[model samples]
Target: MTERLTYYLLRGLFGLLARLPWVFVHGLCHVFAFLIGRIVGYRRAVIRANLSRSFPEKSLEELRQIERGFYLQFAYNFISTPKLLHQSPERITSEHFIMPDLTPLEEAAKSYDCVLLALGHYGNWELFSTGQLLLSTIGYSMDQVYRPLKNKALDRLFAEQRQRFGARLVAKDKIARHIVEYVRAQDGRHWLVAMITDQAPGIGHATYFTDFLHQPTAVLDGIERLGRKYHLPIFYFDIERRSPIQFVGRYVPLYDPKEGDLPNYTITERYARLMEANIQRDPAAWLWSHKRWKRPLEHYPNAVRSARLQALLDSAKDN
Candidate 1:
């Protein structure tokens, strides 16, 4: 019915846009970014505030530059997503997407039943699904854990797009039993459980406060807990956008759960540090508009780990 029709109409529109010349598509993105970035004034302000708080050392002019660049990147990401929907495997791989050194992950996966892949909002995350498909072609079963869109129609469309390459899409809400079963069932075959680690966990969830840039940020402990409980290998996927059409992936190993007394926080810290490093390298690529610190420390004080963070916030008010 209505939902189905809406989905089809959106898909048709995207398909039409995808057929346009690359320059035209990119130009449309630039225009869209300019318009939306202005229209969403409150969101832009919030992003600026967060950016300023995080990078206190950066000048206002520098912050503004980063803000504008982020909007441009956001616009391009939206435009490219539609093109990705209609793109073939050969087209994606041939277009400067390079994965460097997956040997460690491949070797670790053979022994561990599951692998928890820590990724972030940086780069074109949509391509991560395609990359997983490429890995599957070489014999790995990649299951992507995703938070479903609020709109059911959009959710269905996103699921369809992700599954086009044969990778399994598991909703984050329905992931526990499915992940355990998949790991046990697929022994020799590599299993990748990819989750974006940069998002703030919901209120009451266990989180560690870390110094990201200059701000005290709460990092999710879910990945570490899961890896420890399931004895899964942990790896971080570092994505670098080399050009308008190219990306590079670097894999970093975290810890072995089988070893006596694994440092869970250490592993999570390493991943978070890697994400911060990547964001510093390309400030525009990370999602800047997310209300990452929505839940205040007053409401969830236990989540805050660094006393220095509280001191910084206190000092900011005085200044």
Candidate 2:
């Protein structure tokens, strides 16, 4: 009863926000950003440290600007999510979210049973869910792998919003089972598994460590493992913010097993590099508040480092 009530209350709040004008929504987001970025200084330390280390060459003033931008983008992401809850798909696709090219993704879908797309915590990621229509047009459905929130009511709310379009949600833990069942079902439909790969892996689970954002970063190898096992084509989905409310998506092909054999961790390394370039292009759009480098390499006993990465680390240490 409590869970149901909480869900409806939150749903009502979102519906009210969705009815407001976009201009008003933007103003509201700015206010929230100011409060969190300036007055409350929410996770300021972590954001500052992250920005400073990621761009060591930047002056303090430049770093501060990026820090402010990060907060504003962060606020826009969460606040705009609710505002977009009841938005029309036509308005979303035509005005707010634009997927310019479906050629590459569509081609991949034709040749493979499923395609793997790796994304990061960059831009208004929630907005990307609107791309479900684009995927459907190409005969592939989007299935985003996500970690369920601990709070049941909030989780249900998020699940509902995420799946508001035709996109499907696959829990992170059950992804393997989901994939197997999907294939076994022998449904003619294809799936596009979208996995946001930037979050720092937990200790002991950090199987792959590499150079990212000027730090020894740990990345989850799940996407790579699944892609290799399934022999699916992999692509990096890059989101470019056109305006506060508008964005564009581009699919960059990473690997095709049909082409040739892949080196170990190559897909992950390529994704990390692509993501680093993306962040460099728009430093403030990336999530800076995440403790991306909090866990030390020593903490992960089974972490594997490529020879080239180890050489670079040794050179950095010597210098």
Pick by TM-score: which candidate is best?
2
Worst 10 residues of 1 by lDDT: 301-310
Q: How well is each residue in 1-319 modelled by candidate 2, as lDDT tens digits?
A: 9988998999888887888898988999999999999999999999999999899999999999999898999988888887774667788887778888989987876777788899999888888788897788878888999999987889998888889888889889888887776666656788888999999887567888887877778888788888888777889988888776788889999889886777788888988899999999989999999888999776876788866568768998899
Supply the global lDDT for candidate 2: 0.85
Evaluated against the true structure, the overall lDDT of model 1 is: 0.77
Stretches of candidate 1 above 4 Å error? Answer: 39-42, 304-319
Best by lDDT: 2
Candidate 1 colliding pairs: none
- Output the lDDT of residue 282, model 2: 88
Write candidate 1's Cα lDDT for 106-157 as tens digits: 7886677577888998877777777764676556778888988987788887
Q: List the residue pairs that clash in candidate 2.
A: none
How many pairs collide in each candidate, listed in order?
A: 0, 0
